[model samples]
Target: MARFNRKGTTKVLFVETIADPGYMPTATELGTAIDYSKALAATDGWSIENQEIETPDLASTFVAKIPGDDSAADSSLTFYEDDVDDDIETNLAKGTEGFLIWCRKGRTAGSKGMDVYPIRVASNSAQVSLDNEAAKILVKCSIIDRPLQNATVPTGP
Candidate 1:
């Protein structure tokens, strides 16, 4: 999670179905989520939505434009994941079809030997399988956050 410049601020842009969020967002709820993202982006700036970065691994970002006048458009949202390959697209498609879009990709570049990255998610695998609850298992098992640099040399398990 990117930290806010102002301290203790976190941008949490969840892309779950309305069924998961439990209730529809009131004006107050929208304000809270939007405000949080803007606050966090002020720090290091929000990464592109539904994308990942390695070297220093990162959570995904979700793009959003806070509903308002045409002139007021916001951008980017943060999400957690198991690994860079997890599909965050289905989460984006949930209830808001044309209203929003989630761009899912991974940003990989490192030392010469560490640069070769593999696409781990199966072509047919659905994004919902990587929801927070499921990813929690991968995180807890430490499989998703594998040591990329360390794995290259293979100093023997």
Candidate 2:
């Protein structure tokens, strides 16, 4: 196995249209997607967890538990504030729906290290610090359905 750092190797894209959220997108489709890797600062909460259902009976001393409904956890992306053209700000506004493509091992073709998530922007808020720091925007995304995980990166146009 190869050990590597995630910094400078992650690529994030926001695609307006994807025929199928559960299927991997083609190279042509990925080329048309909007690339937001440059403005991104941080990411969090793209995970899944199951609810535990406990079963207790009068005759049983130990409580039995089973997995219940699985759900996607809240996810968010932090991007550096951009004023030019207001592209990222406007597109990622509240209630905006799109496909979020995250390439962990970069966007190299034939690499199976990509995940495409169909998400709707739940909220978008600005983060301004009083100290010397760049302004940022936090975008909360709600996963609409099951995402395409561990997919392959297509060739570039």
Candidate 3:
């Protein structure tokens, strides 16, 4: 297998609602999602952690360990402030519930992807910088659940 850089491989889409939250969204549903790939500057967090259970029994000197429930960490998306349209700022308001479809290996057909249906909330407000830097806004997402992970990218119409 050949190694490739992640330069032009990520795609982020924000959708207001999903017909069924139990299953992976269809291609038609993904197509209607608002594409925020261009506006996104950086992404932080979204780590999954497993609860460790330690069993210290008198039978053995070592403690037996087991994994318990899994939890997803909160994530943040930093988007370049678009003063001309203000699209990112308007849509990603606090208390907004939406699904964030993140294509880690590009959204092309047969590629790997992950869909996270998280509620949008404000983490840190946009910072104003006097130095030569692009103004960016951070949008926090509380991941309540994950509908799909490491799924194949479906072909879109």
Candidate 4:
């Protein structure tokens, strides 16, 4: 078995206006990807939730249950305050802009391991203090829909 590490993982955030009311943008549609890893402290964080529901039934001791709603995915990307730019700050502040979070591991032709998440910024906040060694900005977002696994790598302009 082989083990994987975060050494070669590349994370990018593509900010764009939502063209359709409920659609996620594809990689090709996004231009000039922002190399978020430049300011990122570590690999982009991600999570998923499958809400549960229970049904009442008198005949059985255990209640009937079923999965509720689509699985919701959320993530947070923390950036070093010094490395972030004004453009990113302004975009994030807009709150209504849509973003495509792209991750790829290894750059070789056959080593394409990619994942893309379409998301909307849920919150934008920062941590600053005289006592802390470095200031940091944390952008939290919720997935607009299912992620595009093994997505075609987006090209740059």
Candidate 5:
């Protein structure tokens, strides 16, 4: 197996239209690529919970467990604040906007190390300090569906 590192990783986000659930923004549709890798510090939060319930049977000492509904994927992204336009601040300000995020984790082409997530930005906040420290933004988002793993990058318009 080949080991991958984050040195050459890249991340892009595409705004999705509200009317069409199947609408995926293409490169031509997007006009310009919005790369957030520079400001993005971390991509954390992807979880699935299977709620198990124990059977209430008295005959058996061992209880039988049944799986319940799976919980939605909730994710958080941290970004290092910057002054440039189209940066984290601008993106986060687009509250409740649906977005598709592509995260590529390999340096070379043909590398099959990518993850695509469909998400809606739920909330965002930034902190400032008097000390000589850079500002940071924390964005909380909820996944629309299960993420596509090792998927090809979306084609351009």
Candidate 6:
């Protein structure tokens, strides 16, 4: 298996935590909260991709892709303290505040990809924090590729 730096690859904050606003919402709560609205937008609901599961891994993937010709093969990404489970989210932890994401220190010409760190939300109340009060996370990620020697290199001369 190939190793990657946690500072220079594609990073995506999938789901970005389910803790909506007002009150942190459980997955079920999220369903209920959007119930009325979804119903109202039923006609245009096609835009909404609504497949839910009890597992956060299945919740949704907020893709953070690095624009390029090759994905995955050229870049690698990781999530730091990416998990905000019930025990930690509600209980809090020593080194985690919000969430962190790390990218490989450089780019790849073959492919760029992101690795997901599972976040096991233990409970609704403990794991979920909604609204403005919800933990604000700052995701830092980058795509550092050696300048394409042959590709168009636009520069100010």
Model 6 earns a TM-score of 0.16
Model 2: lDDT of residue 61? 100
Residue 63 C-alpha lDDT in model 6:
41
Q: TM-score for every candidate vs. truth?
A: 0.21, 0.88, 0.86, 0.68, 0.68, 0.16
Worst 10 residues of 2 by lDDT: 15-24
Question: How much lDDT does candidate 2 score?
Answer: 0.87
Clashing residue pairs for model 3: none
Runs of candidate 2 with Cα error greater than 4 angstroms are: 56-61
Q: Per-residue lDDT of 1-157 in model 5, one digit per residue for the tens?
A: 9665664566555555423344434445434546666677776775556778888698888889999777655688878877665456665664666555565653233445445556777778876668886777888887777655664444533
Which candidate's TM-score is highest?
Answer: 2
User: What ranking emerges by lDDT with the best candidate at the front?
Assistant: 2, 3, 5, 4, 6, 1
Q: What is the model-wide C-alpha lDDT for candidate 3? A: 0.76
Clashing pairs in 5: 27-157, 28-157
Which candidate's lDDT is highest?
2
Which lDDT values do the candidates have, in the order given?
Answer: 0.24, 0.87, 0.76, 0.61, 0.62, 0.25
Give the winner by TM-score: 3 or 6. 3
Task: Give the TM-score ranking, best first.
Answer: 2, 3, 5, 4, 1, 6
Q: 48 in model 5: Cα distance from truth in Å?
A: 3.8
C-alpha lDDT of candidate 1 relative to the true structure: 0.24
> What tens-digit string does per-residue lDDT give for candidate 6 at 50-111?
23333234446854334334321222121122243433233223222221111122222223
